[model samples]
Target: MLLLVSLFGCVAAVGAVGTHARLSPEAILPASAESVRAEAVLVSRFGAGEPHLMLLATTSGSVDGQRAATSGRDLTDRLAADPRTAWVRSYWPRHPAGLRTADRHRALILVRFRGDERASRAAGDDVVARYTGRAGPLRVSAAGTFAVLSESDRLSERGLHLAEIVAMPLVLLVLLWTFGSAVAALIPVAVGVLAVVSTTAFLRLLTEVTTVSAFALNITTALGFGLAVDYCLLLVSRFREELAREGSTGPAVRATLRTAGRAVAFSGAIVAVCLCTLFVLPLPLVRSIAYGGVAVVLASVAGVLLVVPALLVLLGERVNRLDVFVRLRPRKRTRSAEGAGAWYRLALWVTRRPAAVAVGVLLLLGLLAAPAALTRFGMYGDRLLPHFSPVARTSQEVRAAFAATVSDRPSVVLLGPGAARSAEAVDGFARRLSRVPGVRRVDTVTGAYRQGRRSALPPGPAERFTVGGATRLSVVPATGPAPQDGLTPEGSRLAARLRAVPAPVPVLVGGAGARLNDVEGVLADRLPPAVGFAASATFVLLLVFTRSLLIPVKALLLNALSLMATFGLLVAVFQEGWPAGVFFGPRGAGVTDVIAPLMFAVAFGLSMDYEMFLLSRIVEEHRRGASTPTAVATGLQHSGRLFTSAAVVFATVTASLALSDLLHLQVVGTGLAVAVLLDCTVIRALLVPALMQLVGRANWWLPGARTKDRGQERKTGRARTP
Candidate 1:
């Protein structure tokens, strides 16, 4: 056993060594979407794509002044000269009004890189590092898709390191208090470390075959420590309980594996199943999270089930040594005697007034969930980063300064064998696009148009748009830059309206706004099926485990309610930015991040983990000849502290994510913390007991089974397997 553990540790250590560097920071988008395909054509055929990097050059005087123009020209020349840059467009010399701020003190330079998303990000990083500070008379800062994503990646890595530093010691303290033994407490922490290392190795392997988002590293680490501690807590607690009863090590370990081991396996499988549902969503970010989440869960279960039992066998009664809080420790009691405990008493009280308790709890959950209806969804962007991030600050400055810039506008790509052959048709299409409500101007190969008229000849090289019989039109919006909150409702509507416009050739809309719109549309189409699969799969698993139709149905309903309430709170905290300065530091985009759906899937799985923990014991008690009410009370007595402790520990670990600079991470962390705490407290403590009491023996009903009298089973002292 020791040799096996050592081998596992060594393998994990090797795999984890450079895992962080292997991860990618590219934005999430569906590869097969029309917008993405348009982007590909622009990159491959036109030798230009959407600008991945933007440099804002600010001057104390007018940007048209000699000093500013010279500096700007020099900056543009440097960028254009770089082999990494596919193309560079600048305000200098040409003096396009749209690229210069209204006050004429700032100018924008847009740059596209020569390769894929990863290559673009790497080139953007190098460019930002080289020219972001100052060039001649201008102060330059980087902001754009790749620049912002790169900054977020750096900050996320730093934040995760800091979170681990802050979280681990606190988790250990909580574990010590819960176990009252320094030695036993360290055991779960060890298993948690193993889980994280092993999962990191798994993710490293994944990155070799497919793109894995750097954001997934956060989930991997958080779930690794949280779920490992949870599973080990159950195993260790059960082992100790069995030890006290059997007065021998071998039987105690065996019984622990039989009871708590089954729960661990089921809980892990359920969590993995829930995460796997994300595979149905086409977004790379969501799929990567699913991969990381499933990997960590499986690693955690394996570590706890194998290493923990081996340690228990080796340590025996000595597992209870080093009791740090011996003075505070309560006297050991039998499972039957524990019925007089607080949780058991609470359960009995809830069962006695089942209807009223259920009504009141449901009402409270309803009120908490009300805010979810008000949520507006948007893609995450630079604004979600910390205020101090240069990329975020630059984006804000660009929006405030420039009246219109190419970075925030959508591009229309007309594709065919002779799409650009007719100048009249191209001009007519450009004129109509320019007349759209939100459009400031439409620049095509023929010329530039504004408000249904030809405004000017093309400002830059027309050949850039006319490549291989394909024409690209840049549609600048009248509303300045795109909103900092990402794809706004207005942006989506504009994309739709533009797509509806008549065109002579096959047109594909591509740009930040269009990509976001496409993502939301795809999610809307795919989410229902993914959710249905998750729900049906979870129902089947619960039915098989509990062997009762009503129990599985009840569990599903309760979990859904808990998740709804969680989303409601998230909408309030993140979207509404209510109770400001408490959680997230600033007001959010007045919209929920698109990542919320991913959070929902993960949190639902976690809620079910606790549900299974409690129900497993309840089912065991019911099979052992106890009445419904008695079984509920006894189950609470046996498993209440176990899951509650696990929830608290899990909450503690996730709550540390609040310290992250990324707003999405903060939202995810705070949302999960709130969900777990609310689940263990109001939902599990009050709702489950009350609802089960109202249902009575019907809770355990199964089809095709002989109905036995409870009195007969009690008299015979016979137990049946669920």
Candidate 2:
């Protein structure tokens, strides 16, 4: 009753508080970064930079002509008339030729809203709901930064529902097949569902104290379902084993708790430690995922350890009732003991030629991991969506027609007080900025300069550049090939040059490119510390769990091998667009998303998860006085099936996520699925047994006080002095 009520409470709370979850791009950076500070200056001095909303107005005729111009004018005027907008600008009337498409049938309307990010998103959503679609001869659709973000949030919600609808039934069927009993199959699903609901409630509570990304929901569901099912499988399988031995529910539960429960606890702890390292990253998106990861792990642990065990105790022998798929396999094969199983035979075969097998597997992994050296990182824009999408089309249109417009969107340098105090100084700085390579133009309060020549200043607001006491220069990057993902080399180079130039006052370079550069910097700077801390935490956990110095180090090295191989495969398939016209398509960006590091974090944790399960069994066998080779083979036999099933289930869940229409989600799902599969098969099945054989007794060696004590015991056992 208590468990039932608690689950109900979680569901109820989720329904009540989930609405507060937000989608934000600002969540990617700190509010105090140089780019953020530049934005603050723009917002306070000029009503710019804060307006993230935009619209792409298209028509059948040339946007430069009078008809399309008039329609665009009317649309912009109407939008500007709204109380929410701080300002609105359109290319049709004043800058017709520059903003129109090459075919001349499309134009852009840039709109800025009043207030902070949340308020602006709300206003933008309202505007989009009200004004998008046909208007006069022009068709207006919501596009640009906020539009893409809003649409992504909508798709995330729908995709979560779709993943659940598709994954749940498939998981149930797989579990039924694995267990061969309807009653046993349903238990893990129940625990998974409970964990998901409970995690949603936890995220809702987290939102009250700090900003939680809507993106977190997707991760929460994935982690919750995958880990919950894994934990339940471990517990249920162990419970059945104990039941066979003890012949009663009570002793079986006790023994299962003692062995499998400890493994589950350590597994969860290791994964949790690995994920918690994300907190060391400076981005809110990573931190939010960390929050979600930790919450779901804890929830899954509770459901499996507390709820499933109690229910098992009540069900007793009936836990295996309602046999289904009974005749799917031969009884002898299905009910094989540890040493009699397929994995045991395979382990024995591999151990016979341990050195050769280990060397071959290592060579294969090395080749697979080689491509990761050429991996490029970048933020994914609308390129993640199909080119047919309105958001994606608008992005392409903007890149084509108005690539060099001196709007608030371009790379900018904000000069502090007295940097460009005089008109001559401002003009000289503008000329110097234009001379820099990769800079298409520089726009300042005085005039716009292209290729070191000042262009005629059109009549407009002079205060746009000169705000408060500081002067701003908008530096347009020369149009070029698209970046791999988030990297904008040209923009980054321009920003760097602008900063290096001598100035009378302090200068802060900012914009999309600079902001992305800062994001990359934050990751690079924090990576060493984050990795060190996570490794230390994982090592401590493994040391306590295995009580062997060499084993934990071997485990870490094995995880690294699998992870590097996974990364290499990802780079080849996703970044280089291998088998291009099929899996990724022509629209493939030919680069990995900036979020690939996050995938590595999650995959590494999952690798440790399987590692813990396999090692725990091997350590147990070794402690029981078995020789090293015998323990390795027996451990593989006992634990290989368990880890394999968990991997299949986990891979199934994550692969289902890959079926999402969203590209980033697809990357996440595929990356994790591939990592889990490799970890289970190549690493666990072949490499682990072979490597353990090669190491022999040294695999269980412990150093320091324990080693000295063991040495003394060995000496005292045979008294040659007597």
Candidate 3:
């Protein structure tokens, strides 16, 4: 009853808070008056189209997604009633479209706004008031990328219910089929589910301060289902072996807990640690992942270490055996999923020649990753929605029409302060900027300066007043064919020239383009740390698991190769735009964004997960006095097929996310799927075995370093020495 009450409390709190915060842009952005330019620049270029960001809020489903969206719409209608809002109305949709995913209770509505943040947010707040409860029992609010930063938190909330409904059954059925058991197999999962559900409720408390992205739904669900299923599988499989020997559930469960449980606890700790690395950056998105990751992992550990044993105590003999899958196959064949015995022989050949296998695998990854190099890092927003999407189509038309009216298309701001109200100072700066080559036009406060529109944000005196008031001058660059952020030489050149401005006015430049440039810088600075930290941690985890420092180092080295080769290829393909978007699937990138490093790091971390999982069994056999060759063969035979299936599952789910209308998610999902499939097949099967074989025992031994430790084998023989 207490548990039930707690659950009810959580649900109630989520609804109460969720309604006001879902998909709220106000939640995510660093709100400062000075930061308004980041929001304003786009509004200036897009005109009324800038308000389109609000659509993400409307579409996000919470207690009142529809009602909140309706409020935004109604406010828009009122705003349209004024002459000043005539242009804003042009971009406003009477009723925005809402997205319906697997569940219909959820939905999304799209909208647009004007100016930068000031104009847009002022408008957004009006829409928000109607949806923020107080009006009635229903608190209406949208949640998504732009509408809510807390969208992630809402997504976390969404996943809480989803874990029980979707993931639980799915995990149960999958485990039942995999284990062919009743209580023995399902008990661990039951424990894991309860623990994770409880932990997620705790996660809600975090929403008070930190922003959570909706994507966290995937994170927790994946962690909960994955760690639960994996732990239970390992424990129960061990129990089955022990049960046949001890002929008792209590002893078998105890034995399984002693061994597999220890491994699970250690492994879960490492994974939890690994995930915490995401918090190395100051970015809230990554930090949110850390919090969510830690909670689920801790829950998983608790389930495996505590709950499973309790379950065993309760269920007693019933927990010892079963037939969930009703299979007629012999039990011996069941233990070995892949044809790994044969592959083991193949691994021997590669062990004899590590360089050849390593090189071959590197070549393949290099080729596949080639497209990533030429990829452009663009925002995967509604803007990238199919050219036919209402907003996309509208934007295209708007862009074309504006091209005729304005001298410049949507572009950049290269800013510096100017000298007084002197027309000469503004004129000289404009003349120099106009001659800066890539610049289309350089407008100043001077009467002679012309293109269109009078200057409210003019140069000289206006710029001076701005400086005294913590404001600065802005020089808008031509849209042209330049890279989105300052990635290219042209962008670099523009930035450099603007920074060289001689006027006394203080200069601080930012826009979508500039912030994006900063985003890249942040990634570059943080990625190396992430790589070194994650890789070192992985190595330590493997070392402890195998009790062989060399083996862990080899794995680390191979992971490095896979990661770097992929990065090189990403640069070659995505950054360079090789094959011009063919490899990228439908939408082509001209130049990849800085987000790639973070994404790549994340992909590599997950790839490490499969590597650790599939290979641990083989390493275990080898440690138990099986010949290295025999161990490889037996281990692969046991876990190979399962690894492949899991990889495919991960890939398939990730692929589904790619189908999202949002380009950002689509790009992320695409890259993740590619990495997983590659790791599972080429990296896991062929290259890893081949490389390990070539290294022989050296794969698990550091050169010039050998402790005469217990269970030490001098060579590859079956004999072990203490």
Candidate 4:
């Protein structure tokens, strides 16, 4: 009791420390990327790379009217006066006709902040809270890159908190239903709490060394609890079974540790190994999840091994004593026998129709996975916010009011050293850029050029382009409809076209399009290595554990199939916007988020974790000289209840995240839940058994194994060949 109490207390201390973990999440571009460098140059030179906040001033009359114009100017003046603001621009002063809505009742106010992202966001939040609602003659609202993101952060935090609150009681209920004893159910929940607390502390420590994503908090808690419960379920269930057979505590624990404990350890290791692949991703968001996932898995494993065994030792046979819900009590001997017999019968049934079962399951999985070929990967924008949110509503109104006249923010291009900065060079480059298909205007330090015609530099901020022996150009694209992913088509085309332009110096295009392009490229570039690393790691681990070549190959293939099917569902439901009622937020971006592949890897690894459990028992039985068919049947009978129960708990915890308003979090949560369910039911239950039946003795075949003469082996009293 003292030890358990001390351990729990330690976890609490660590969790408190963990609360200080900093979240320094980045956007599409890493700081070192060329696009980021271009953005940095612009921000340093011009005091603005992009508008941090876009305040919309709306009125019942034309924005050009005296009343609305005066109010708009007042709002801009107040915004510009804020110490946190670097500068502010509005239609009333500069381009009233150009910036006004077709309906003439709304205008945009673009504001830039004067510091690093963290400081700027902190200061921007203050500005947004103060200025978002109302002003004389005009109702003011805010939504831009920064305002939208800030709102998302708040919603994500709230959603994560809500998920935890809702998931815990449901998890407890599932545990109670599964174990039939309140004491048995409570033990896993306790282990889950310890895992979450310890992982939080560890992640906090990790933050001191490197950056962590705010999303990691959500991932850590969900995975920590789910994994802890899973490992504990395996341990407690096996311990109970041992007690039933041995009629004592110590020996039961020892036997359970030798078998079920070993399986839990391997499963935990596999999960950790799978998540490690995320480290290969260049994105901070993906890497943080990997770090949190691995830490949580380890914490859960440690809690199960250290804490659960102690609980088992203390409680002994009494682990089954508390049955608060009598109707949920464990089945009698006859029922237990029937379940095992049913699994055995089920395995035999699959064996008789192995070919048909294999073909049918594959066809269903293939059809389910077909939509994944159409998957589009991009960043989630303001569209992910709830439709009723202030930011979301404001953004929609702003788009409706001003989208037709809104000028495309020019893609800023940075020139490398030895680049020509002379008037002649600048003129020649500007003229060439203006000829690019979508180029509306090209502004250089020297002057602004449009359609190959040179105009003297405007009286405003054009000269800010020259700095540090390098020069920049704002290549504005012709105005039109932007792409659904938020990168305007002209901007996207302009970036590519600008890159292709032969310039004397090297060029780096930076803006929304460039940032997204870099992000997509990085994900694609890193995907092969990440997938290779995950697959190779899984193969090596399974090979060592099972010592069979075929088993690892089959497991990998099946895991891939289930994951592919899940991805298809995600693409169809989230990207294609199928059955749209439950999918809150904007219509799909016509693509999954860029991080979907990473989620697939993580899900596949988790699926393999359960595969390890099932195979461990089957392999054990095989080595004990049980025929391959009997070994497979007995192993399924032994592990089906535990694996199914664990899957339910894991799916429940992850599925809770779908309630998040952040579409990215929703994708992760919903996708993970679907993957786990598919693995538990279709893959583990049906496909795995059928595959094993078809494969027969080859499932356990290792290199250099002699084929026993059945009669000779039996006559010699040696272990029968599998």
Candidate 5:
């Protein structure tokens, strides 16, 4: 309680001070256009121009029109003090509706730099120092698109809190329902709490080396709480069954330690491995997500193994009391009659009906996934904020006023030295860029130079055109904020166009477009490799664990089938033009993210946890030489309840994640929810044994004569050499 209070207090202080979280400049400021090739383009576009760059600060908010507008006078006075600051402006209106228009509160401060690059940067530093906190309480905040999004830090924070508030009770309900004891719930929840703290401390330290995203809190909390809960639930349920059978918590814990503990260890390792695959994408957001996920998984494992068990040892009977369901007492252990004869009945049924179930599941997912195909993609980052938000207003206005042409987008280009900074050089380069399609507008600082245009100069960074006497030009294409996935056709076109630039100057085009292009390129390039990694490794591990080549192969094939169905569904809802506002909630008519595939791949493997756990006992029984049908029946009987419970745990976490306003959250939440639902109901329970029965001995095949070396060499006792 003390710690919770302290943490909340800190969050409140930061929120009150208004800088606990801030948007990354990259996320907020528009990316350089797809057309830009040279940094000079950025330098020229708004750099040397009549100072289009401005910092409009208000020590006030929307609450009071009179008092906030009055700050404009104080702002004007401060502006008058600095000679280098010219045309410093602020739009403070006395009436609420007056300043509420698109243009209000966004002011431009025209700067006069005294010297060169060093001087200008120094001046910028001074500008920040002078203006940053000059105003008092209810102080000045930033106003550019990025600045506006930074302010939405509060909203994202609120989102995380909301997800937790809604998710926890449901999980507790599941725990209570599972254990029939209030005390048992603490084991998992406690472990999760510890995970949360340890991860926060680690992340807090990591913040010193590098910045953490605003989503860090949400990520850690979700994962920490999720893993703790799931791992604990898995272990606790097993431990309870052991206790009921043995009539002693000690023996129960030991059996659980040997059995469920082993399963937890295996699942934890896989989840960690799967989450680590996220790093394969090589993006900051992805890396952060990986870090957060790994921490959470570890925390969950730790909670289940170390903390929950330890607590169980400490307070065995007492833990049961907090549980409400126990008071009711069941006459006997709950078991469904249908599930009783399930293994043989299910096996025979499935061997009879695999195609029907497969078709049904595919058709269902196909219907859900149809929304993503015909979709277009765009991110209204801060626009997702409510109408009351100031940042939302700021973003709306800038986008409204700015040039809609692709050339006007903020972009950067890379070019070598010793190039011409003249109209002839620039026009030749412009013609080259102009020819390649997707090149909306190409403006060479050199062309601006020869034409004697200077208003665009300061903003344009024109003079930097000649690096070592060779000229470089920056191109700007007008576009909305670039896509995060970076693999879209737009990203592809930008890269192709940059290569197509016929510049004697030797140019490398990039900025927002190229950067995103690179991101998309890496994703496309690496996804295959990651899939190979997962497939080969899973096959090897499953083969060794199950000692059945056919089972492993079939397992992987089934997993792949489920994943494809998931992707199809993702494409349907996010990529195709479906009004996702119904289920996934509030999404526009567009396809989902490029990274969605990778995320699903990694997450699907994790989602496969229940399947692996449910099948392990059955497969082990099969290795002991039971008939496939008998083994399937026995395995489902023992594992079915846990499978149902685990799926519920996964779904709860997923639903919580879905509640986050971020699209990334929505993608993960949706994929996980659908995949888990399918894995539990359609894949694990029915598909495994059916497929196994169909293949029989082939399921345990080994290659070549070497197969004789792997399994018990069946003597000539069964049959003489044919």
Candidate 6:
């Protein structure tokens, strides 16, 4: 066993190196979407794509001043000269109003880097490194899709490292306190390390076949560590309990594997199945997370079920060595006396006043969930980064200084054969597009049009629009606050309006705005089926595990309620920015990140994790001839502290993400932390017990299963009571 573990560890260590380099930082849009198609044509035919880098050059005087103009031209020339640049468009020499700030003290330089997404980001990093800071007469700052994403990736990596630094010691402390022995505490940590390492290696290999998000690393580390510890907590605790009962290492190991090992397997499968629901969403970010999450779950389960039992066998009674917290640990109690503990007492109280407890907890959860109704979903932008982030600050400056610019403008690609030859048709379409409400101008192969009139003949390069029988039109949005990658509400409205306009030929509308609409549409179409599938699978799994119909239904309802409350809290904290000083996240962007769906799937799975822990124990007790109330209390006594410790450790791991400057990470961290805490304390502890008590024998009812004998219930009723 030691040799096998060591060999696997060595391979994992080798593979994990430079894993992040193989992962993508770019957002993956659906290829089936028209916008994506247009983008493909634009890149393939026109040698142009969305600007990957934006340089904001600010001057003390008007940007059009001779000195500033010369510097800007020099800056643009320098950018254009770079071999990495595909193209560079600037406000220098000929100042377009949209490219210059209203005060004329700042100008925009848009640059598209050559090559693929990763190469573009690399180019952006190089450009920012070389061109940022003061030039002769201007101060240049960089912000664009690539720049922002690059910064986010850097921050995310750093945040993950920081979280590890913060979470590990805290996890060890929790384990030590829970096990009352440093030796036992280190066992879970070792399992966690093994799981993380193994999953990291799996992700590295996964990247070789398909695109995976760099963000997957974050989830891999957090979930791998957390779930490993959680499963180990169950196994280690069960083994200890069985050790005392069986009075032999081999028997205790066997018993522990029979009970906790089975629960861990079921729990891991459920979590993995839940994460697989992300596959229904046509987004690589979520899909990558699904892949990483499943891998982590499998690795953690394997380590706990295979490696942990081996370690326990080897250590035997020595597992209790290094009793650092022995003084603080409670004395061992008889099975009957164990029911007198805090968790058991609380369970009894909840069962005694089941109706009142149920109603009160439901009310609290409802109130917490109220804010979810107000959630507005939108794609995030540089504003999702810290205010001090260079890209974020540059983006803010651009929005404040300029109105609409080429970067935020939607592009229309006419793709049918002979489309470019239809001059009159193209002219009519361009005029109609310009006439749309909120459209500032339309630049096409023929000329620039404004408000249904031809304003000017093609100014820069007509070849940019007409290439290989395809004609492109750039629809400049009206002057306003910058749309976040053209994915804001206003941007979506504009895209919809433009799409509604009559076209002379088959046209594909493409831009961040059009892409946002496409993405939202896909989610709307796919989300229902995905959710139904996950729910059905979970229900079936629970039913098979518990052999109880009402229990599965109850678990589903409780998980949904907990998730809704968690979403509400996310909306309130991240979107509404309530109690802004607490999380230290960026100011609210007025809408929740589109990542909410992903968060929902993840949190729901994790909530069910704790649910499975509690239910497994309760079912164990009930099958042992305990009455409903006694089973509930005894189950709490057996598994409550174990899962609660697991929740705390998991919460600690995820909550450390709040320290990240990336708002998306902060949202994930804070949301999961709250979800786990609420699940363990309010939902699992109070509500589950209360609801189970109210349901009575129905909680254990299974189809075609004989009801418990009345005489046996009567026989065990008194003996089971605490």
- Name the candidate, 4 or 5, with the larger lDDT value: 4
Off by over 4 Å in 2: 1-26, 62-67, 92-97, 101-104, 332-338, 406-410, 420-435, 446-462, 481-487, 500-502, 704-722
Clashes of each: 0, 5, 56, 0, 63, 0
Question: Measured by C-alpha RMSD in angstroms, how accurate is candidate 4?
Answer: 3.3
Off by over 4 Å in 6: 30-32, 62-70, 93-98, 102-104, 427-464, 478-485, 500-504, 707-722
**TM-scores for candidates 1 onward, in order:** 0.93, 0.91, 0.71, 0.91, 0.74, 0.93
Task: Output the lDDT of residue 609, model 3.
Answer: 61
Alpha-carbon shift of residue 265 in model 5 (angstroms): 1.8
Query: Taking the tens digit of each residue's C-alpha lDDT, what string does model 2 give over 1-722?
Result: 54674667576466645444444543788777888888777766776663466677888987767877777777777887888788777784577565566777777778888877788878888888877888777888777777887777676567667877887787777788776678888887777777777777776777778777767776777778778767777788888989988999999999998988999999899888888999998787888889888888887887788888888899888988877777765665445464667777898899899999999999989999998987766666665666667777766666555654433244455465565467777788788888887777788888889888898582256677786678888776665464211144444455557667776567777776667777777877998898889888899999988878877888889988998998888888777777656875664565566667676777888788888778877877665556777777778887888778888888888887766666787778888899999999999999999988988877777766446544654575631210
Per-residue lDDT of 497-609 in model 4, one digit per residue for the tens? 77777776666677766766777677778878878887888888888788788989999999989989999988888888876566654466455666666777567767987
Off by over 4 Å in 5: 1-143, 247-251, 312-323, 327-330, 333-352, 366-390, 404-417, 420-426, 446-488, 506-508, 574-577, 581-591, 596-598, 660-662, 702-722
> Which TM-score value belongs to model 6?
0.93
Model 4: which ten-residue window has the lowest total lDDT?
A: 483-492
Q: lDDT scores for all predictions?
A: 0.84, 0.76, 0.53, 0.77, 0.56, 0.84
lDDT of 3 by residue, 1-722 (tens): 33553475456345434422332232222333222353453334323222333222223344235564455455446655533332433122442222322332323333454444336554555554444333222223432234332232334344345434644455456555666667655664565556556556655667666566445545565556556666666666666667777988888888887766766776676677677777776555556667777787777777667666666566666664687566653555433443434555565665666688778878777665555444455433323344433445433433333333211112323243334345565555545555554554544445222233233344444432222223223445567543223334345456545545564344444444344444455556776797678778877877777767667776676666666565665555434544535544444444554444555544655566667655677766766666565666666655565556555555554555554544445456566667767777777777777766666777556443345432365454545421
Better of 1 and 2 by lDDT: 1
Candidate 1: worst 10 consecutive residues by lDDT? 479-488
For candidate 2, give the lDDT: 0.76
Lowest lDDT 10-mer window, candidate 3?
403-412
Model 6: lDDT of residue 295: 85
Candidate 6 lDDT, 94-151, residue by residue in tens: 6778798778888999999887777877888888888899988899988878788778
